[model samples]
Target: MAVAGVSANRLELLTIADAVAREKNIDKEIVVEAIEEAIQKGAKSRYGAHHDIRAKIDIKSGEMALTRHVTVVADDWQPEDELEEFNDSAMVRLTDASKRDPEAFVGKEYIENLPPFEFGRVQTQMARQVVTGKVRDAERANQYEEFKDRVGEIVNGTVKRVEYGNTVVDLGRGEGIMRRNDSIPREVFNIGDRIRTYIYDVRAEAKGPQVMLSRSHPGFMAKLFAQEVPEVYDGVIEIRAAARDAGSRAKMAVLSNDSSIDPVGACVGMRGSRVQAVVAELQGEKIDIIQWNADEPTFIVNALAPAEVSKVVLDEEADRVEVVVPDEQLSLAIGRRGQNVRLASQLTGWQIDIITESQDSERRQREFSERTALFQEALDVDEVIAQLLVTEGFATVEDLAFVEPYEISDIEGFDEDTAEELQARARDFLDRQAAILDAKRVELGVQDEVMAVPGVTGAIAVALGEGGIKTVEDLADLATDEIRGGYEVKNGERTKVPGVLEAFNLAQEEAEMLILQARVAAGWIDASELPQPPEPEYEEELAEGEYDADAVFAAAPEGDEGEVVDDEVPAGDPDQPENA
Candidate 1:
């Protein structure tokens, strides 16, 4: 009866391991191995801690085997640690083993079978902990493997719990976390409440894989649109861009491959059903469905929907645009708390500045007067001729000085002689300015070598001298940020650091070029080793659509719609103030 009871207990051990393996979704072999380790520990506690004991469980037969092992070592063998030196029952000197066996080798191992013993209270607790920990590690690994590849896909989950403004989601197979900011504003989820979110990122953390979820990510709206719109799912229409203020508002740019279908119409659905479905999901977010245009300016116009844009001035170098709207539409164009323009800017990937038509007109008049005055003073010409030149697109003295004579002569009321006289006077004015700037540079003690850098003009040299950069070496030692003026973080607070030529408003590339040229001139670097400048990006005219302000001006009849026209002010101009 005692032998039968021992057999039953062996089978029961295997049963418990199989049950745990199934419940934890781990390999049965792993469970058995953990049980083996637990048994080894308990045996050590019972058979003296010095013995090298081990345990193994049979896979097919429900039997557990125990063994005590002693390894034969060479005379020169030493213990790995002080603890091992004191616990040397597992090792037998080869010379001593040879006396007992007459053929002992350095690596020979002798094993002894051991009887199973009853588990003490401490032993049972240790065995339970070992099994639980191994199962948990396996579960975490399983969860990570199952969900890591699912990132960027929308998922449905139940709210497991909420802790400190973060919601933990039980994704049937794993768990995901949606932080407070990731959730739509003012939206809340209760325990067991079903919620849908986008898996933006998956990270393997020390405790487990962190599955990050978000309802506010731009991708979330796009994915929701895909689910509701068949064309999007079938790839007939593509969501080009998306921006969201979460629950408040969003703008989505969509394009259709087929010209027959309107991408915006398809996304909006019949009577706004499809969009309404998405809006319901996003807590009534007002969506602007913009029809994507190859022309970035036109796309921006579409992005700022429900608000009329009279004109758009694009500065491609800065990736910025200034939009002129009717005076009455300013509040609507800017939206509630500037949300509309902000979303439009995000959708078009451009920095957008909105202004009333009156404001734009006033600024244009100011620029026109400024340019006319500059031309009048520099060319020593009458106001009428300067006004005519300004009207014909001449904004600077350099424009008149270097222009082909015929171009100016073609202007209304201007002849070849008049153009020549203007050019000569403009050249004289520029020469005088250069002389003055050079005198200032000399007074400031700037070295002549500083002017030798390819891009360094007299004005730049004067500015550099004022900024305490007197030599090419000083300029060479400076970083681009020092010359371009960038933000610095001091004690976690961002502060603007003024550049030596900050007033010049140089482009980042331009500043880098100046630094590289200075370095080459100072013999700090070879001219040939300098990196080539990037090719300028030119905007393509919109596909059978003109999105440029120049196009708008040319198409519209003057004094008909009172449309604001672009003044053709280039960005980074020293005389022009930023629209921002």
Candidate 2:
């Protein structure tokens, strides 16, 4: 396109702008504005750089106008910023301008028409830069608007180039980048090669809007399955959960709202045609399509498929589960480098442990022996009787000590006298153990008030003192995570934080209760203000002459006259799987 003074026809300018707009895929009005800016820049360079030069172009007839404007300002006009010097060429004082023009006032502009001039060598270069910069900005804006809301959708593109393990993709109208970690393992892409990627993120930066693409995102597999399986796209069968190990392996849990359809079979298709399509696109990544069950344990069993599970032990409070399989199936259940169990854990939202049946049996035997030993030492019984008590589900000495006399007497070959004798021995053992732990707590400088908190046991008091929580105030200040354990980021890595009562195996709710009770004991809160838990089912009062260990050896402050609650410690369930 020729300049204003080059005798270029009026319609010729609009034709050039229209062509540029179509080629750049931007609006024609943006092109016209950019050209007007370019002309204004050139006029400034030819006239005075300080003058306020303006340019306008009529889009229809392509009529051009050039004008210079000087605005009247206050006599004491100040520049916009400290470093900006006042320009008299663009601004004139009202008092001075009023002498030349009788009606001149502040903010009034004196306008003059300027004849169009040919562009010089430097002006032409400056105009080119102005127009190019404006057009580039408009293109970036258009690109950002087009792709900003397209994240999580799949898109097709051509590989523009690969630099430093990052693939740059030309997404037709915009460019996207897939970082090394976001690409499938060992996958390669060459320049100009056709590719399909998931739009995972779109970020606006100073340079441009970045369309972050990925082939390894778990959502990519879900989208692939949606495209391959009609039921998934129509929401007849839902993809409940998905986990991927990039190009190596993946697991997907599907659920069918309609009882007539089998979710797994539908995903598998006839002879696995549907899943095969997804697998081929993922570079032959193995896909396990498991039917999801509403019951978590059942779902977890399905998640660890192909390896028959002998048993599943769930610790609901810990969000952990242990799966026992036959010895020969251990390797298959764990997969290569533990990938199978890891993906299962991710898919089920549970921390999974894979164990052989023999290993589980050994662990159970160990726990049995340990409990048998405890009963013998606490009740002064022989191995036969100790084993009998363990076999009957008596774990802690406290349980045997505090249980109703009838519960112990009902055992075979046991009479009232034998039950009474066992009760005496169990209570004596608890009294001795409590005294020992209380002495140790004192030696560790634990305050008596720390033991007075509801739910605090003698052993728990000692544990707290050893963990530097020696006072009720100290315990009151703690968050539940401090007592139940959690993770923290340190040195740019996640590190496990050991809880103060980690060894007690306290549940999250138990930890919260302990802290809240401590807060009341510390005078930080009122006991009445605490959340009241549902009362436990009432049991009949123990026989009048029965030794009450709870009343005698319960930990308490010197002056505390309040009731003492039972141990916060887990009431060891003898039947529980040892490794659980």
Candidate 3:
């Protein structure tokens, strides 16, 4: 150890540096850096700025000292409390001031000594505060030792505490924080819970080191498998990929290095002991062990298990699948609320739509029927006009006896000018055959299908027509309760009036008239808008041959199979009654 006469205790600085380096486990250079900074601060405080002062330290010898630069003066001034300009006015021989002349003069140059210091109580207190901070900084560096190289490694720790939804784990030498987002959902940890997680990342900070842990990382499952399977450790099996719905389900794709030793079997021990261990660690989260495949269809089939797929129509460009199965298997293949297909889609990164046999057939049949009906209906109005005209004996223009311009105009394709020309030429010929034709009323005899109701009248028919409620189709389209609310009947002391046309009272004739008008407006009685009449299911009869096709054909009659001639009317006649 070394000592100083008027400045420093030489051994003290060396001893302090050695102590800081050893206790904080840091390099001596760091402590030296701290000491150099401290001395510069102390020197500035002890010496005023008027003096140009400097300091040096010898770590090996543990010695420290200070020196001051002074300038000589020619005026009656000493190098004590005055500015350097006053000293500049003095002139003394520099060589004499260097030798300490007894009679010193102005304008001379020399150097003076500033003694080394042993820090006073105030300075020592400040130095100690700085040393404490520096040591903590050094310790922070040491704290990162275990975490810096351990990122992405598996670690287990006891839960120290929970704060602000973050779990703090005691990792023996240090603590790590498992943020709420980093934890698997629906999973909770207690104070003493022994939690296993992957080291996600590490960061060095001023206070200490921070290690981030995660349980939701997909790699955590893969790492856990490696720990349980020896083949995975020795490179005989590989985990191809893993997809997880954390805390609920996970699918892991694995393949074998040697095809003979099944990769899935190796990961799942003889009785599933290996995977069971992993499942227990994961708090009963289900694991699907899938065999990896280069062929996507086979992989998808494995991903969706227990539900057999009848066919898979893959759309490679869109990365989707249309899976079809038997009608009875639809619910099973779709699983409870489609959970099975959803998980399979997540695992395979594909969109899947599941369909049943009946649904597929119905879809195709609807398309075919619509296409055919559209083709036939496009130009078939001529047939309907021909049949109606034939019943009226408007079979030929000459049969009319006296052709009217309006009668010719009534024909759909005949123009007005053509009708006028034909009527003028054919009047006499048309009039001659008019008496031989049948009565117009007898030609069209279709009647109203509904029974007449009492108290109801044509007032309701006029109201229904004006209100756009003209038909059974319109009435059936409304809910029963909605229609019922529209009707009003007198109750006790109040006179009631119908809010809707459906509730009006009418006589039988009026009801018949209403029904006839409604049918004409709606185009049907039990309208198409009503619930469809169930088709006759002749499946059993047809299968059992209850009726022979040959006998049905033999029983059918022929020969005009027609009605009488009493109802025939003249051609181009306009007075025929309308029928439905």
Most accurate candidate by TM-score:
1
lDDT of 2: 0.85
Each candidate structure's TM-score, on Cα atoms with residue i matched to residue i, is: 0.78, 0.73, 0.48
Residues 235-339, candidate 3: write the lDDT tens digits: 899888777667777778788889798777788786778988888877777887777766566666656655666656666544677776678877866766676
**Candidate 1: where is the Cα deviation over 4 Å?**
1-14, 32-131, 412-421, 489-493, 522-529, 533-580
Q: Write the per-residue lDDT of candidate 1 for residues 1-580, one digit (tens) a residue.
A: 1111222377777787788888878888887787788788878877888899998878668687889999998888876887657347888998889999998999899999997677777777776777677778888888899888998899999999999999999998889999999999899789999999999999999899999999999999999999999999999999999999998889888889999987887888887889889999999888877777766556767777777677777776667788888898889889999999999899889898998989977988999999988987787778998899999988788888898999998987878888888888988999999999999999999999999899899989999999999998999999988998889899999999999999988888889888998989988889898887667554556877547877666654323222233423111123211111
Model 1 TM-score is 0.78
Q: Pick the candidate with the highest lDDT.
A: 2
Each model's lDDT comes to 0.83, 0.85, 0.61
Over 1-580, each residue of candidate 2 has an lDDT whose tens digit, in order, gives 3633323566887888888899999999998888888888888877878999998888888888888999999998888899988788888998899899999989999889888678878877777787788789999999999999999899999999999999999999999999999999899889989999999999999898999999999899999989999999999999989999998989998889899987778888887788888888999998888777766666777788766677777776677777788899999889899999999999999898888979988998999999999988888899999998998888899889889999989999898899999999999999999999999999999999988888999989988998999999999999988897899999999999999899999988899889989999988888898888676553456788886666554432222222211222122233321110
At residue 542, candidate 2 shows an lDDT of: 77
Clash totals for all candidate models: 0, 0, 32
